[model samples]
Target: MTTRPARRTRRTGPALQAAGIGAAALLALTACSSSGDSPSAPGASSGDSSAKLGGTVTVFAAASLTESFTALGKEFEREHPGTKVTFNFGGSDTLAASITGGAPADVFAAASPTTMDVVTGRNETATAPTTFVRNRLEIATLPGNPGKVASLKDLTAPDLKVVLCDETVPCGSAARKALDASHLKLTPVSYEQDVKSALTKVELKEADAAVVYQTDVKAAGDKVEGVEFPEAAGAVNDYPIALLKDAPNTAAAKAFIALVRSPAGQKVLTAAGFLEPAS
Candidate 1:
């Protein structure tokens, strides 16, 4: 009695290969669909991540930027929460010298491109400096016209006690340009190192008048009076700012620079009498 061999039910060569290929095709399809649904890196946002910026940013800025930049600094700190902004406000040239001389600073904002050139020439900036605003000269005089000063020529009155910025500074250089444009020779009773010091002379009544930036007079409020002169148009100083190459707070420094260039910053600067820089 020969019993027929049980029919083999096992999958042979081609059938096994076909099944394996089908399994692989399913996995490839699964992988392709999952790839399009991956999540983004955590904490990513439209703006720079706040977590990336938390440190003290030391800013060396021109005296003329004191009020506006200080306001912006407060806003910056408020926006950044844990970040702190410190400032050293003085003449652009003085600030540049300090930075070039190894002062620990994160950013530099100069009242003139020439002063900024001092830093850029030394390759101290992380990036090329950008002009943020333009400022024209204005004569800051004692309130109520105590000196009866009205024009740039009046600053030349022999009886008038006038103070100007040191010729090496931006304000002084602009003053010189304005004077040269008007073809008028006027000497100051003193040459202050920065626009603020020159404005301070008039504010404190130490001098009868000062040739300074319109923004300075505006920042001083009623402490001084502003007088516009036509020659100021020819000597408008372009303010430039940059992030330092060796900034202690590189992230915070870059954020501060962005704030200064924002519309909010332009509002503060313009409200302080600074002219909008050309696009």
Candidate 2:
């Protein structure tokens, strides 16, 4: 046998800057970025039909999809025996940058088109991304609505402690939209990296309230209360999903995406509080 040397690698393009997500979670991509292989899924033709749905499918998705996607991942594994499904859920912008930075994921699901463009703009998608679900913002308050935050303006109170998503991510973008629509200016005590983090601030009683996705409030159960405002309608975010151009498990990726768009998938998502994709 011949002896071989381990390859030395360097960090590439703000790869470690997505602090909203665990640095250790993205450590798998700690190597030089490849220009990416051909933008084709070899065994699969086009769309989510796929060739054979075996192997592990690595999906980089927005944090909001945590619950629903987890259930779907389990369903997928059950539907296709011997197949494993793994996920890296985080802020959309962070996930997008990871994909473009050559993280070697099979699919990318973003909370908004703007975030999805970060990957698509770099030509990292095997095909056009499809909008799979939508979400609207809501005020997550203490379990009993102790803050009496009846409207978006209520969050502006100086005595109240509020948390929000950082402007770089999709949830933050939608929150900004809603605020702008209502002509409200709010300075959250801290800006979180993802919707789940923002909601957690309220659930943990660390903050009086936080602006996050309605789905998050529902997922939180009785730990927090949801307050819907009309302005949220203007800020609904459309989630998009696509196969990565250099996916290592294209067949599994396509099959997983197909399952997400299937009727059964929509049922699970809807039950988790996600809205249907706009036709």
Candidate 3:
């Protein structure tokens, strides 16, 4: 036997073709599995998943939320790198007006639900609002109780330089309710445009007393002394927050909201003397 008749030559063409086909099949399968357009693909970007979390967000918040929100803003930026938060803090009514007038804003935090309703009615809100905190009126006086303004009834005492928030603002409305509940008539020296302005009058000694949120007095610290009165129970103000309908950065807005609702955010708010929202 011709030992090995001539070494049979093995044809490599079919084997090579089969290997090529197998490689092509693997490529096609990979393309299908990784299709970015597929709804079930975890890497697909869509809905809340697609919302990229880095962008500038402009927030218009009530003056009462200034300190707490500012702190929270810093924390948010730290947690979400590449994000920036710009804030406009003032009276809720004024902030609402700015939003309705077409000012570019990503979020709004109002001192009162009524004011929030105003902004929502203007079609400026993108999402359902949530109450984040509650605040109550307090009598702010100069350090050392110089005025001796002891009670809501004392505020009506003649010659006391008492300042109140403008009636259009949340604090002013709450003041009215408190006064009505106490059956006391108050003739303030001035109707401040915002709560901080009212508190500032007390801090500067321009006014002996002012009706402001308890949080404001806490923020003022030694600048002013806070006196809690019984009538405040009747006039608690609720703080509400929501994303704006025309927000330039919706992802940032939602993230900011999440931060505010987070435990860390609550700590900041509570440290500033805001009460937790009712359960």
Candidate 4:
């Protein structure tokens, strides 16, 4: 009876045991949070995740971007691993029409800003465009001065077999502007759908001379001699690029756009004879 308050025994019942277990779980969760491995990590995983880059991205680019873009695409695949870039290269206008008609494309690169405006006007562009390159007109002629076509005015000579870009294409439109500025009239033997075709005619010696982008002549190398005309200054075309509004692979498209604006991509484009856009 004098044991007024026997020393209390430590709790060791099922309820106490359950309470301890609950405390342990709470501590473990706190540790996980402090260790930077909480549910937030999974939320972050869904953003900018490396797992989202394996899909294929289709790009519709101006025919002039064919060589440089192809090289960039190869490099992108090599660096990205599992990403594929499929390009549909043609006149910028044609590419815009294709995209507007619901063709699947993740990106668009045009040789001229005007053509890019066409696609952008339709709200087909996902982002603001960036000018990546500038190309000036050049007079391509057969090797060894066969036609002696040196100036824009000389192209007006009726005897010369001149090839020009169709008015609908960037190069053709630029050629017209340059000619109009110089007050020269050129009656081309054929109006090509794109610059490549116009340059091809001169490369094959099918035409005595052709007005094409300077990069085109450089790409052709010895196939055709490039003659820089003074009037070319009047017709410099700007190349622009942007992601498509309805891109099936938005991440990949943005990556491609970034690459094109990167130093590595610029080097490739420059090597192919394209000029870096003026600062």
Q: Candidate 1: give the clashing pairs.
A: none
- Give the C-alpha miss distance for residue 21 in model 1, angstroms: 73
Cα deviation of 86, candidate 3, in Å: 0.4
* TM agreement with the true structure for every prediction: 0.82, 0.82, 0.81, 0.81
TM-score (C-alpha, index-matched) for candidate 3 = 0.81
**CA lDDT, every prediction?**
0.78, 0.78, 0.78, 0.76
Question: Model 1 compared with the native: what TM-score?
Answer: 0.82
Model 1 bad stretches (over 4 Å): 1-47
**What tens digits encode model 3's per-residue C-alpha lDDT throughout 40-155?**
22322222434557879899999988777776676666556788899999999999998899999999999999999998998889988889889988888878776676678878
**Comparison by TM-score, 1 against 3, better one:** 1
Model 3 misplacement above 4 A: 1-52
| True lDDT of residue 251, candidate 1 | 76
Clashes within 3 Å, all models in order: 0, 0, 0, 0
